[model samples]
Target chain A: MAQSADAKAYNAKVYVTLRPSVLDPAGTAVRSGLSHMGYDNVSKVRIGKYIEVELTAESEVAAKSQLDKICDQLLANPVIENYRIEILEAVAV
Target chain B: MAQSADAKAYNAKVYVTLRPSVLDPAGTAVRSGLSHMGYDNVSKVRIGKYIEVELTAESEVAAKSQLDKICDQLLANPVIENYRIEILEAVAV
Candidate 1:
C-alpha cells in the first residue's frame, strides 16, 4: 500500500553522548590510539552513537515528537547519556 | 606540563554515515525492530558513529584541518562512509 499524500517523510538525526560525569572506556581507548598515532595534543575523547531515522508523519511537529520519544526511550540511556535530535528536510517517499 | 596559552581547546563533532548507495543491514534490522514494536511509519533507519574529540590547537582553521585528516585517515572509511566535521566552542580545561 502507498503512503498517504499528506504524510511527510523526514530524516531525523539523533546524537547520543555520554554525560560529563560518566567514565568512557571506549573514548579512552580511542584517545590512546590517537596519541600513539602522534596526535598527542588530542585529549578528552568522548565517543557516542549517531542514529538517522526516517519516518512518515502528518507534520514536522509530529515527527519531532516521535523522534524525541524514541531517543529518550530507546536511543539513549538517560542515566548515563544525553540525546539531541534534529529534524532534517522532508523528502518524497 | 601545561598547554600553551595560545592553545585553544575545541570540541570536534564528527559524524560518519554510510553512503546512500550502500546496503545497510544494521539499518534494515533497526527498521524491522521498530516496525515490530508498532512503529509502522518508521523506515530507512541508518546507523552511524559520532565522535567527540577535545583537542588543543592554535586556531579553528588548524583544528578543522586536523579533524579532516583524522576523519579521512582513521575515523571513517572513505570507500563506504562520508564524514562531516564541526568545531564547537572552546572549553577551559
Candidate 2:
C-alpha cells in the first residue's frame, strides 16, 4: 500500500471516563434504576463520553499527538477524567 | 480455571452514537471549536455517549441478552441512536 507521509486521513475514537476515585452520582442513579427495573444483576454503572474525530495528518504518530492535545484542550477534563484514544487510517469508501 | 456458571461478574462498555442518517450538530460545534483553536487539520467531529455498566450474570450469553434489553429500554434509543456493546469479565482489582 502506497502511503503518503505528507497528508493522510485518520479517524480517532476517544473514550473519556471519570477517574476511579471520583464519585459518579448519575451512575449510582442508573444502578438504582436497573434495580427497580428488576435487573438485579447490575452492580455498578458509570457513564462517560465517546467521541469520533476525523482529521488529516502526516502520520499515525502525528495524528495521535494532535488528538492528545485536542482531548486535553476540549474533549476531557484531565483532573477528574481520563481519556483513551484509538486511531485508525481513513479508508476511502 | 474453575468458573461459576450460576453467577459471574461482567463489565459492559456501551457506545451510543447517532445513526448515520442523523445530523450531529454538537459534533459540528466541536469541530468549529477546534478550527477556531487553530486545529484546522480536523475535518469532522462526532460526539457520542460511552456507558460503563457493571453487572453480574450467569454467563456471557445471559449478560448479553440482559444488556440488549437494558439498552433497548433504558440506555439507548433505537430510533436516532445506535449502540454497540463490548463485554469483558470484571477482573478483580
Candidate 3:
C-alpha cells in the first residue's frame, strides 16, 4: 500500500456486544427457537452488532483515535455494551 | 481442553452481512449522521450482525455443519445476506 502525503482512507470493523451481566431477551428467544427447530444441543445465544466504517485519517494512529471516539459516542451504549474496533489498512478511495 | 466422550460444547461466532451489491439504507443514514456530528472525514458505513452461540456436538466438524444449517435457515437470508461462522475451542459445560 502506498502512502499519501495527506489523509488516507481506512476501513474499520466495530463489534458491539452486551455486558455479561446484562440480560439478552432477544438471544434467549433465538435459543428457544433453535431448540424447537430440533437443534436441541444449543445451550446459549448472544446477539450483537457489527459495523463497518470507512473514513479518512492523516495516519493509522489518527484513524484509531477517531474510531475509538466514534465507537464510544455512537456505535455502542457504554452502559450495557462493549465495543471492539479493528481498522483495516488504508485503501484507495 | 478435554472433551466428553459423547458431545463437546463448542462456542461459535457468526457474522452476517449484506451482499456487496445490496443497498444499505441504514448504513447510509448512519454515515450521514456522523458527517453531521463533525466527523466529516467519515466516508462510508455498513451495519451487520454478530452472534455467539454455544452448542454440543460430537466434533468440531459436526458443530460447523450444524451452524451452517442454522445460519441458512434462520440466521441469514441467502438472497441478500452472507454469513461467516467460526467455531472457537470447546469448553466444558
**Predicted model with the maximum TM-score:** 3
lDDT per residue for candidate 1 within B1-93, as digits (tens), equals 235777888988999999999988988987887777777898778999999999988888988998888888788999999999999867765
Model 1 scores a TM of 0.88
Write one digit per residue (lDDT tens) for candidate 3, span A1-93. 223567788989999999999999999999999988988889899999999898888878989998888888888999999999898876665
Whole-model lDDT values for every prediction: 0.85, 0.89, 0.89
Q: Is the docking of candidate 1 incorrect, acceptable, medium or high quality?
A: medium
Q: After superposition, how far is residue A62 of candidate 3 from its true place, in Å?
A: 0.9
Residue A2's lDDT within candidate 2 is: 27
The whole-model C-alpha lDDT of candidate 1 against the native structure comes to: 0.85
Q: Please provide TM-scores, in order, for all candidate models, with all chains considered together.
A: 0.88, 0.91, 0.92
Error of 2 at A71 (Å): 0.6
* By TM-score: ranked, best first: 3, 2, 1
Ordered from best to worst DockQ, the candidate numbers read 1, 3, 2
Q: Top DockQ: which candidate number? A: 1
Spell out the clash pairs found in candidate 2. Answer: none
Candidate 1 wrongly placed segments (more than 4 Å): A1-5, B1-5, B91-93
Per residue, candidate 1 scores C-alpha lDDT tens digits across A1-93 of 235788888989889999989999998998898888888889878889999998898878988988777777667899999999988767665
Model 1: clashing residue pairs? none
lDDT of 3 by residue, B1-93 (tens): 223577877899999999999999999998998888889888889999999999888888988998999999999999999999999867665
